[model samples]
Structures are given as C-alpha cells and as structure tokens.
Target: MVEQSTRATDRPLPLPRANLLHLLEQMVLIRRFEEKTMEMLALNRIRGYCHWNIGEEASVVGAVTALTENDRLITSYRDHGFAIARGTPPETVMAELFGKEGGCAGGRGGSMHMVDIARGYFGGYGIVAGHLPLAAGLALAADYLGEDRAVLCAFGDGATNIGAFHESLNLSKLWHLPVVWLITNNQYGMGTSVHRASAEAELYKRACAYEMYSEQVDGMDVLSVYEATERLLRRAREDREPSLLETLTYRYPGHSYADAGKSYRTKEEIERWHQRDPIRLFQRYLEEHGILNQGEYDLVERRVSQKIEEAVKFAEESPFPSPDTLFKYLYAEEGTK
Candidate 1:
C-alpha cells in the first residue's frame, strides 16, 4: 500500500516567514511564466509542442526548493517550472521557448530540450522514460568520484510503466546510488488518465519491489512536498539511500498546447481539480498563518507580471541562431575525424 501524507489540516512544520514568502513568490513566478507562455504560443512567438505546468507549481517548487546548489536535477519535457525554480534566468528560458540565440540551449533545443549544466539542471529530455537511466548514471558518477552530491530525477506518471524506470530503480537500489526519483503524477499521462494506463494506480507502492523508501504526497500542498523531498534528499546525501517520491498533482492544461483538455476529461472534473489549485492553496495557507496579506499578495502579482513582460521583451529582442553555425555542437570532433 502507498503511504499517503496526512491532510493539510494537520499543518506542516512551521517555516520562517521569509522562507514561506520565498516559496509563494516562486510559485507565483512559475504560474505567471506559464500564463505568459500560453500567450506567446497563441501569438506564434513560440512553436513546437509546449507543455505548461499551470496547476502543478507546488510539486515543482517544493521539490526543487529542497535541493541544494550542489545537487543535480533532471526532468522530462515539461520543464519550464523546474528550470525556473532551480534559478535559471527567466529571460533565457523564455528565449529558448522563442528559439532565439539567447536561450539556455542557444535556441536549438526549444521548449522540450532546455539544458543548463552550470545550474545543475542536466536537461529537459523529450523522450518518455529515457532520462531515468541517465539520471542513474549521474548518481553513479557522483558516487564513483566520491562527490558529496545527489541527483533528483523528475518524470511524469506515464513513465512508471516503462522498462527504463524499473531497470534504473533496480540498479540504483542495488548500488546504493544517491538519487531521488520524483514521479509527478498529474492524474493524466498525456490524454490518458492514470486509471486507464496502470493496474496498480497508487504509484508510490511500485517502489516496494525495489525496497526503496517511498511515499505519496498531496502535490497541492507545497509544505508537505517540501518537507518530504527535503527529508528524502537528506537521506540520499547522508546515507546514499535512494527514494521514490510520488506527487499526486494535477495539470490544468492539456498534454500540449494543441490539446483542448476537455476531450477525455470532463469539464466538471477539471473544475474540481481547479478548486484545489496548488497556487491558491498555498496562498491561502500563507494568509492563514499571517505570513502574507492582500497588499503583499498584490505586490507579488504585480512583480511577477512585470518580470514576465521583461522576459518576453528579452526574448523578442534576442537574435535567432545564425544559419552559418547550423552544424555546430552536433558531433564529437573525434567521431567526425
């Protein structure tokens, strides 16, 4: 059976006001960034398949916030929030979405392949379940090199059934790799619901086969996610204990920009999930704790709005990659020779 977190009524550990506000601000930034991305896609400023993490802010922020600067991170294609939370500049992320030269990937990777090794964000892999083994390898390298670091690998619910997931987890457990596998179960794997896809829907229990410490969290509750991830990360860092974390979150938008999001799921179901939107839930929690008020909330909204506007301007003004450099970074020199 999957271990579920207690309801929000139990209250999370009391965090400092500054940390709480920081978490709130990060969530707002991600929400605004995603909203602006939708607008940009509509304006044709960004092309190709784009997935927005509109309602899953807490899952992204809480997990990333728990990681230290030296820790490594890898995630699947829906990665704007992950990159932004990990301290990648919004301007560069936006520019990448716009396919401009100022982007983190220099405009070539676009939305589905963002990368910033300097910030410890390994990549935004586009393939399904493909990055799991690579994350395991990163953990192995850290252990082999005697580095005091851990790897946090994030993937969608759909990936749970893939072979790579099992292989990586088994090896990670066998070798005692310092890694945390975060399964962002946003209810639907693309257009298919989790119920339709898997026999054992409570994904956290899947970790049992590998005998890894695992738990399912209320992804809408930012504090719960943060506390759980922080604890697991500490275990991995200190004891080299790998973990599997399943975050039960929801995505308001469709699998991609092209999806209307209503074909498979009903409007009422979507509305119900919207009621528990991670941003609003966390905002209410802050207000209840007297850590935030209307004025401060308004200020955050305005600041995030302005930040997104500036990022858009930056992306628009940035140049596209020159055609002359088309073949750059494609192949290794030794291989080409």
Candidate 2:
C-alpha cells in the first residue's frame, strides 16, 4: 500500500485561460485521433498489435505538458496519445499506423513504436518493463554530458512487479539520475485487475524500497496530474532526484483490439469510471470556469475532426516502404552490405 505521505491531494494551481485551452485542445485531439484509429483498425487499415490510449488522455497530456522541449520521454505500447501530446504530427502517426513510408519510424514501427526523437519523444517499447533501464541509461548519459534535461519514463501498472522496474529504480536513486517514472495505473494491467496481480496495489509505495521521492495523483483529473508531474519533473531537473509517480487512471477500451474488455470487468464498473472521463471532466471544468462556451467546444471538436480526417488522408496517400529497403537500418556496421 502507498503511504499517506506519498499521496498527493493538494489543489492544483490555477491554470491560465490560454493554458487551459491548450490542454483541452490536446486532449480533444487525442480523443478524436484514438477514435479514428479504432475506425481504421476496424476497417483493417492497421494490423498487428494495436493498443489504443482512449480513456487515459488526461494522464498522457498532463504529464507530457509539464516537460520542457529538451526533456526526453519514453513510454509503453499504449502510446498514440503520448506521441501526439509530445508533438509528433498526427499525419505522421497515422501514416505509421497505416504502415506507410512517411511514418515517424519510416513505417516500420507502426502503432506500438511511434518515435520522434527531435521532439524528445522516444519510441514506445512493446515489452513490459523493458524501457525502464533504457530510461535510466538516458538519464545517466544526460548527467554525464552535463545536460540539464531529464528523462520521463512512462509504463503501466503491470510493469511495477517486474524485476527491471526495481533494478532501474535502485540504480536511479543510487546514482541520482535525473528521471521520473510515471506509472499509469489504469487499474487493470491488460486483463488482470490490480487486486489480482499486485500484493500492494497502491504502486507509489514501491519506490520506498529505493528511498526515492514518490507520490500518487488523481489521474482522472488532468490538473492534478499536471501539477504533480510539474513538481516531480522540476525536482529531477534541478536536484537530479529520481521519483516515482503513479497516476490512477482507467482504460475504456479493451487491453488490445483482440479483447472485448467486458470479459473481466462489469458494465457498471466501466460506467462508474466513465463518469470521470478525463476529457469530459476537463471540458466541464472549462465550462464552469467560463473558459469554454458551447461555441468554443464545438469549434474544438470541428477542428479535431478535420485534423483526424486530414491525417487519415495523408496516411492513405503515403506509399508503402519498398520491400528492397527491408534490410536498411537493421545493422550498425556500414560495411555489412
């Protein structure tokens, strides 16, 4: 169980109207993009292991918005939202999903590995807990180079029980590496509920073993997530402190395209969580604060719809990578050919 001291219940800072609008725009974009992705998947435009980040837009946008452009971000396979939030063009992301040559990864990575290094968004890892050590290494390299950047590594709750998670945290704390482990505790790790899989479901407490600063935030609330991430990221950048932050969120869709998501969870439970839908909650907040009127909301929706349509068109227009180029970028040695 996570200790009380590590739980974050502080009220979020007041967000400027412009900033709130920006956050809302990003959230809306992610929502629409994910919806479009589902449509494409249903139409068989995208194949293979396609994981959608439909219900966790708040966590993705909030944490990523807190980072500087120089900071690096790595995440697990449910990464479409993260890539979009971190500045990867929707067209490029859609193309990648379509397996076209214009993709961010040259159409090779597809949905599970959207990468935009120039934007500081490292590609997503398909293996659970595999990127933790790589994140630590990135932090170490940044420290060695005297760079001020920090690395934010995001993973699911399922990864918390893995050995790599512990090993990476231990080394990060010991070396004072500038990294923040953002665990998106969406309750169910794939299909297994936290209660069934974890002995200590409050995951932030796991950091206690490494003597690191850790906290739990209301992942359903975008402001809460953003504030906690901002604070923790500041510590990492200024003091080289490694921290663990668990955001309690949920996924509305199935774990993947294969699972129905209803086999393990009840309709009531899904509805209860949807009551706190991040996008809707944020939209209500904006409306209550007089920042978003119906007209503005509709405008955002229209804009996002158009953006996704353009992205789909771009993906359709893009050509597939040549079969002859399959061996390209596979080897480090230049003379291998």
Candidate 3:
C-alpha cells in the first residue's frame, strides 16, 4: 500500500550517505554519457538509430537502484540509461554503440539491443510493446520455478496503446507473477504527445482493468521514484503481487537521432522541461541538505567526464567483429551443418 502521488516532492528521503552520493553520481554519469553519445552521433562516430535519455535520468537511476542483484531488468529501445544504471561498464556500452566486438552484445545488437545477461539486464526491445509479453514470460518462469526473483519491465507511454500491454497485465495479475511494470511516461511517445495518443492519459489507471495495483510518481524527482519503486518491488518479491508504476518524466531529445524533436515540440516546451531537469533538481536537494557541496559536485562532474572520455577511447580502440566469425552464435548448437 504505497502512498500515491503524481508530483515531485521537495523533501529528500532519509537515505544513507553512500546511497545518496551513488544516486547523484549515477544521474550525473547518465547525463554525461548521453551528452557524449549525442556528440558521437553527430560526428558520425556511432551509427544506427540512437535515442538519447537526456531528461529521464531520475526514472532510470531511481528504478534500477531499487532492484536487487537477482532481479531482472527489461526495457524499450531508450535503453542506454538503463544499461549504464544497471552497472554495465561505460566502455562496453560505448563499444556496443560503436559496433565493436567489445560491446556487451558483441556489437551485433547495436543501440536498441544492448544486452548484458550476466548483469540480469535482458536485451532492449525495438518493437513498440513487443517486449511486454517477453517480460510476462520471464515473470511466469520465475513464478513457476519458485525462485525468489522479480522482474522490472520498463517502456514508454505509447506502448500502452499496444494490445500486448493489456495482455501482459491481465496475465501477470491472474497468475500472481512477481513483476513490476514501469511506464516511463516521458509525455511523448515518439513525436506525438501522450495527450494526443492515450485516451486515459493517466496511465496508472489502466491497471484497474486487470485488477492490478498501480501508482504514478514524479519521474523528475529521483527520491520519489526510488521510494515508490522500492515499495512496489518489495510487494512484488514478498507477496508475489504484480504492479504498475507510471513515472511522469520528459525526454529532451526527439524520438531518435534522425528527428530533431523540433517539428512537433515547441522551443518553450523543451525549455520548460529543462528547468525541471532531474539531475539539477536532485543536485539542489543534495546541496541544500548539506549532503553535496559545490567542490564535491565539481569533483563528481570531473570524474564522470573522465570516465566518458575513457569509454570513448575504448570504443575507438576496440576492433569490429571479424567477418570470419559472422556465422558464429547463429544457433544454440554450433557445427550442426
């Protein structure tokens, strides 16, 4: 019975010193990573469709931090943030983006398909809401096997319109599977605003049709996201109750690398969201609380910048997959032919 709120809270959660710092660091790191990624995409160093998570740091970092080591994480194509937040090395992520063999997916999956199985992060799905069924399947497996594990499935607002969203929710509720369905409602799904697409713009209400518990929180506030996620996950793990959480956030960039995100969005709209930037909001909370000072914040920024540079360097130096090994990993059993 998590208390429900759809707005950002000014009060900071009573987190430990280390946890607070980790949250700040992760948000800053993600912002820097996306900024660097944007630069690389512009310079043509990284190829293929790239979606920047410039404004959704709190949604990613807060949710990921709530999960245990054994929990599974799955998400939509806006995945780099989730991957980095889940502890996949920046170097490997950049390499994957660069299509180098050093990538987490062996450079085969590229940006939309980043996978790190060892870290319990299932690959990102490219199709809209296509991964929802897979997430339900994973939850069913854990339920059937009597495993003490839960799954967190993340997707965008537009995904709700897809039939699979309803199907997954119905099944998860009926079966009492351990899963937390997180909707990162960044206001828009691609170029269209959520209002223009979803009939029930308050997405959390959709869970009511399936008799599942649902709540919405301010995605720009990392503390609120963290608290709600932690409670929901606890219920999922302990009581085997599936739930839906909608985080009200926004993405600064357009849908992908190709779209400039300006055709459908106004300059004023983008600037307004920037004023409530997740990283800046969290930083204000931390500084005002006497947890992080200007000097320490600068140190964090410098450290993250260096890490991003190293990641870029690693991507630059890593080799692309050799053509000779192209046929490898095509099947579960090799040498069949």
Candidate 4:
C-alpha cells in the first residue's frame, strides 16, 4: 500500500511573505527561461540535447527553497530549472546552454550537464541512474567528514528501474547516509508513461524493499513539495535517515527538444495536466490568499522577462571557449604545493 503525503490545503503557508514572493519569482524565471530556451533552439542559438522544465516549476522551486545553502543538490538531465532555483545566475545558465565561455560549466557541459560546486549543486547527469551512486558517494563524504549537510538526488521515474537506484537506496539506509531520493515522476519517461513502463507505478513504494521512509506528493503543488522535502531534509540532517519522495508531475513538452510532444499522449490528457499547471496553480493559491495581487504578478513577469533578455544577450555576445582549453578539465591533477 502507498502512503499519501500532506495536501497543500491541510496547512497554512509556512513561509514569510517575501519568501513566498521569491518562490513565485523563481517559478516565473524558470518558466520564461525555458520558453526562451525553446526559442533559442529554434534559432540555432542553443545546440545539443536540450530538455525544458515547462510544467514542473513547482517541483524545482519548492524543493530547492526547502534546502539551505550548505545542502547539496543533484539531478537528472532536465536541469535548467533546478540550476536556476539553486541560485545559479540565469545568465550563466543560459550561457552554458549556449555553450559559451560564461556558462556555469564554462561551456563544456551543455544542456544536460550543469555544475556549480561552490553553490553545492553537483550537476545534472546525462545517463539514466548514473548519478545515484555519485549522490551516495557525496553523502558518504559528508558522513565521513561529520558535516551537517544533506544531499537531495532528483531523478525521473525511468531511473527507478535501474539497479543503481536500489543499490544507492540500500546503502544509504544501511549506513544511514543523509540523502533524499526524489523521483520527479513526470508520468512519462521520454516516450513511455510510468503505467506503461513499471509494474509498480507508485514509485515511493519501492522504498519499502529497502525499509526506508517514503512518501508521494502532488508535484504540481508547490506547498506540498516544499513541506514534504523540508520534512525529509530535516530527517536526513537530524536523524541521518534516508528517504524516497515521489513527486507526481508531468512534462508539458516532449521528453526532449527533438520530439513533438503530442504523438505519444492524448490531447485531453495534456489539457488535463495543463489545467493544473504548477505555476498557475501556485499563482491562484497566492491570489486566493491575497498574497499575490495583479500588480505583483505583473512585476514578477516584467523582471523575469528582463532577466531572460539579458541572459540571451549575454549568451549571444559571449565567445565560444578557445580550442586551447579543450583538454583542460577532463581530470584533476595534483598540485605541486
């Protein structure tokens, strides 16, 4: 049997007014950044495999908000939203997508790979389930160093089927590593739906095998995501417990840029998800509570638009990395000092 997590309505807003507004701003920024990214791809400004976080804004913003600066984050290929939510400058993120020198990864790690270690964002890994072990390794490092940090490893439903997911979770629980396994279950993994792909579609229940704590949340609801992630983070930090959180989300677009998102899914199904769009849902919640009025919404839109424009301009003018630096970052070398 699957356990239901807290509903967005069961509790009052836990954050301050400014923080609530900031959440809205971050969601808006991610939405606009992705829209612009699609446009840039159309214009050939951004190349390579690009994934857009169009409908999953709440999942990114809410969870990232629940984290402290010291907490670490790692995620799968659909990562621009996470990077922005983790406070990576939109300009640098866009530059990274543009494969320019100013990007977060200095232009090498394009669309699928974004890393900002100083901010504790490990990066988005390209291979499915490949980063689970890395997340465990990071958590082990924290355990060894006796640091008070937790690691949030975000991946899609597809990864749950991989062997590494089980290995990571098993070790995490056995060793009591401070790691939260977040499954951003966007219904479909690439062209396949969870129902079609996995025998146990309710992913959080998979944690039962490992005897780890787990819960499923409304991924489209920002408050629910924040509350659950915050709870799990606290458990990881205070008790050295590991958990699996499954966010029931949907990706508005196709899995990646190349496919037209409509063929595999039905029009009615798409419309249904759109009606509960994470951004609009949160906006309504704010409006209903008198927290975000029309003026505030407009201001956020204007600001986000300006930021996206600046990012695009910066990416456009930035130079591609010179050929000489091609072999620089492949591996770390010992310092003579």
For all predicted structures, in order, the TM-scores are 0.96, 0.95, 0.96, 0.97
Worst 10 residues of 2 by lDDT: 1-10
lDDT of 3 by residue, 1-337 (tens): 1224533334545689789899989999999999899899988889999987889999999999999999999999999999999999999999999999999999999999988889999989999999999999999898899888899999999999999999999999999999999999988888899889989988999999999999988898898899899899889989999999998899988889889889998999889889989999888888887888999999999999999999999999999999998987888775464
lDDT per residue for candidate 4 within 1-337, as digits (tens), equals 2125555555687888898889889999999999999999999999998888888898889888888888999999999999999999999999999999999999999999998999999999999999999999999999999999999999999999989999999999999999999998889989988988899998999999999999988998888889899999989988999999988888898989888888899999999999889888888888988899899899999999999999999998889999999998877768732
TM-score of 1: 0.96
lDDT of 3 at 60: 96
| lDDT (C-alpha) at residue 248 in model 3 | 87
**Given candidate 2, what's the lDDT at residue 8?**
24
By TM-score, the candidates rank as: 4, 1, 3, 2
Lowest-sum lDDT 10-residue window in model 1: 1-10
| lDDT per residue (tens digit) for residues 1-337 in model 2 | 2123222224333677899899989999998998898899999999887788878888999999999989999999999999999989999999999999999999999989999999998889999999999999999999999999999999999999889999999999999999999999998988999989999988999999999999988787788889889889999999999999998889999999899899999999999889979888888888777778999999999999999999999999999999999998887776664
Arranged by lDDT with the best first, the candidates are 1, 4, 3, 2
Residue 161 of candidate 4: its Cα lDDT?
Answer: 91
Query: Model 4: which residue pairs collide?
Result: none
Q: Judged by lDDT relative to the true structure, which candidate is superior, 1 or 2?
A: 1
- The residue-by-residue lDDT of candidate 1 on 130-159, one tens digit each, is 999999999999999998899999999999
Q: Model 4 — TM-score against the truth?
A: 0.97
